[model samples]
Target: MILTKQHLQNNFAKARETNSPYVFVGIKAEGVSEVIVIPKKSFDAKEQFYMNAYSEDLTHVMNNNVMITGLSYGDADQIPNII
Candidate 1:
């Protein structure tokens, strides 16, 4: 069977109905079959901020319960890596 964009959409629709945090999908192309799945990981607040509503102002994060820790940037080159 040939996989089309509709197939992918159907897969996503089915995934959304399930309670699993990750979705797995398989596709066949060029006589090869491959499986794809989203990896389930602990929710990171920083990622949510960056992906959903990231802003340089950071006023929202400053005022929200976003759990900001390990903020130790005192010098120009002392910026720490955010999770």
Candidate 2:
């Protein structure tokens, strides 16, 4: 799926309203974009730790640098970056 401005707006609003992190994973296959939004207080430390480790492993395996960006509620204009 392609990430749209509206998608960003909604997710960022959700993040701000719920005071939680808006997380999405972009897969590099057929230009597919996968978005997964976990609710507030649902992503605990253990999951976070495993996610971080998995991300690191993917980075090493793919030999690509991973970039994590923090977006404010008003920064929904970052459509290109997300796509």
> Model 2, 1-36: lDDT tens per residue?
433334434554566566654444333433344333
TM-score of each: 0.33, 0.32
Tens digit of per-residue lDDT, candidate 1, span 46-82: 2343334422322223334332121211222323221
Error of 1 at 50 (Å): 22
Quick one: best TM-score, which candidate?
1
lDDT of 1: 0.34
Global lDDT scores for all candidate models: 0.34, 0.39
**Per-residue lDDT of 19 in model 2:** 65
Model 2 spans with C-alpha error above 4 angstroms: 1-18, 29-31, 49-81
Prediction RMSDs, each to the true structure: 19.4, 9.1
Flag clash pairs in model 1: none
Please identify model 1 stretches exceeding 4 Å from their true place: 27-34, 40-83
